[model samples]
Target: MIASVAFRNFKALRETSLILAPFNLVIGPNGSGKTSLIQAMVQLRALARLPLRELMPDDERHPEGAEITFRFQPPFDGLEASLSCVSESLCDFLQVTPLSTGGGVDDWVGLRARLLSLKSYRFNHEAIASTSALKDGGELAPDGVNLAAVLFTLRNTNPNIFECFKAELLRIQPEYDEITLIEQADHTIALGLRLAEGAEVVPSDNLAQGTLYLLAILALAFDPEPPAIVCIEEIDRGIHPRLLREIRDLLYRLSYPASTGDTRPSVQVVATTHSPYLLDLFRDHPEEVVITEKHGRTAHFTRLSDRADLAALLEDGSLGDLWFSGILGGVPDEQ
Candidate 1:
């Protein structure tokens, strides 16, 4: 799991450091640099697969360029990269030259691959419903285009994890009891949802947006071999306010193990949300909430628990209430 992240000269994040938890919720108003922070991490992770120059080119317009550091848990060493020079260091052992030098040292390939395994969910309903078979050993696509194929593979290979996914899905939406896959003539499989024990199956294309999103999330959360971290943007976009709690619970369960025989690997979740309902879900657990505020060209990150004023205000009101009233600092300033 990622313990902390620090970035400088990365888009709106001029200089900021944030201590992350197993499950993190980033709440801020529009253009407050929430997405920028996620993009910075995603870009750093992409370095493992792409050259640094292509990801973060040296442009005179932004002389400072960008640098990011990720500190992970035990067994995996920390990594820091200079996007401007494309230099990288793993702990204190090795240092690599610029990207021009065959993309730095290759000793950190394993660590880089783990970081690159980080998944970002950008739900595409039409794509999620696609019946095309993906290559063997393929993982879930970012847009969820290959969701059916991936789930099919899981159902066939790791039935236990797939069953856990179905159980979690039922918890999120009690209407669905089972998930089925329909084989098409072209050898592709389409996802089918059984409403009840013997109810008529609903095709993936016919499923609700919220249902599809929840399925996609559950699949990632319960995968036999889960990613080190997952970044989700606008997590509450299609879901209803009442169901946000369930979604929050699902995320919490994925981040930490429960005593109910959930042996799946713990997967960290970093999600961005504009929904007050979602913010309220983290009221008691303020440490997991990171509030972002943009001032001019720089973005600042602060944990809700780190702010004494916010804590005091919470004595009389909820976190969402404080944020909506602009006491939390992420709201728009009305001059």
Candidate 2:
């Protein structure tokens, strides 16, 4: 997991740093660098795994002299990677340096693998409902376009994990008796839901928007080959407010596997949200919530747990109420 991230000249980030927890919920008004921060992490992942030319078309890249630095916690303590853009043109070239002298080439390789394992998702309702062509199993796409294929692969390869994923969905929406994957004559695949033991399978296209989103998330949480770090944008979208708690628990399950008694390695999760309902869920875990504020041209981040008078502040109202009332810094300024 990343202990902290510092970046300069990256979109609204300008020059800012944020201390992160295993599972983080970033809340703020629009354009306050919430998305920018996640993009910065994604950029770092690209830097670690892809060619510089491949990243040239990225909008998050600064023209020149922009840099990002990461400080990781153990078992990666004292290991840091810094990437600086050294080119003057839009074709920015990155120079990466590992600051840990004690770590060997194997350590660097491990770091690269971890970075390669990072996956950022911004699920689209329509994309999640669309049919997917059959292909070799891979990570869920950023837009979740391949959710069906991914689930299909999981069901075929790892039935245990797939069963867990199905159980999670059923818990969330008990109306579904079973989760199914239908393979069409064209070899394309679509997600199906069985309303009863003997009921006909309903295709994903007929599923509600929120059901698709929930299934996509459960699939990610129970993925056999889960990413080391998962970044999600608008995590609360397309779901009922009542299900936010379940959503929170699933994300926490990714980072806090011990809480569920799962033996799998924990995954670090960072999610962005504008929903105050979701923010309230993290009230007990203030360290896991970061508030973003954009002042002038620079964006700033503050962990809610870092507040000195949090006890007194909670007295005013619930965390969501306080934030919505503008008592919290994440609210928008009326200029």
User: Highest lDDT, which number?
Assistant: 2
Q: Please identify model 1 stretches exceeding 4 Å from their true place.
A: 50-63, 76-79, 85-110, 134-137, 258-265
Model 2 CA deviation exceeding 4 Å by range:
50-64, 86-92, 98-106, 197-200
**In candidate 2, what residue range of length 10 has the lowest lDDT sum?**
87-96
lDDT of each: 0.73, 0.81
Lowest lDDT block of 10, candidate 1: 87-96
Predicted structure 1: lDDT: 0.73
List, residue by residue over 261-282, the lDDT tens digit for candidate 2: 9889989999999888888887
What's the C-alpha lDDT at position 66 in model 1? 57
**Residue pairs in candidate 1 whose N, alpha carbon or C atoms collide under 3 angstroms:** none
lDDT of 1 by residue, 213-292 (tens): 87777777667777888888888877888988877877776787563457776778899998888898887888899999
**Reference-based TM-score, model 2:** 0.90
Q: Assess the local accuracy of residue 210 in candidate 2 as a C-alpha lDDT between 0 and 100.
A: 91
Against the true structure, whose TM-score is highest?
2
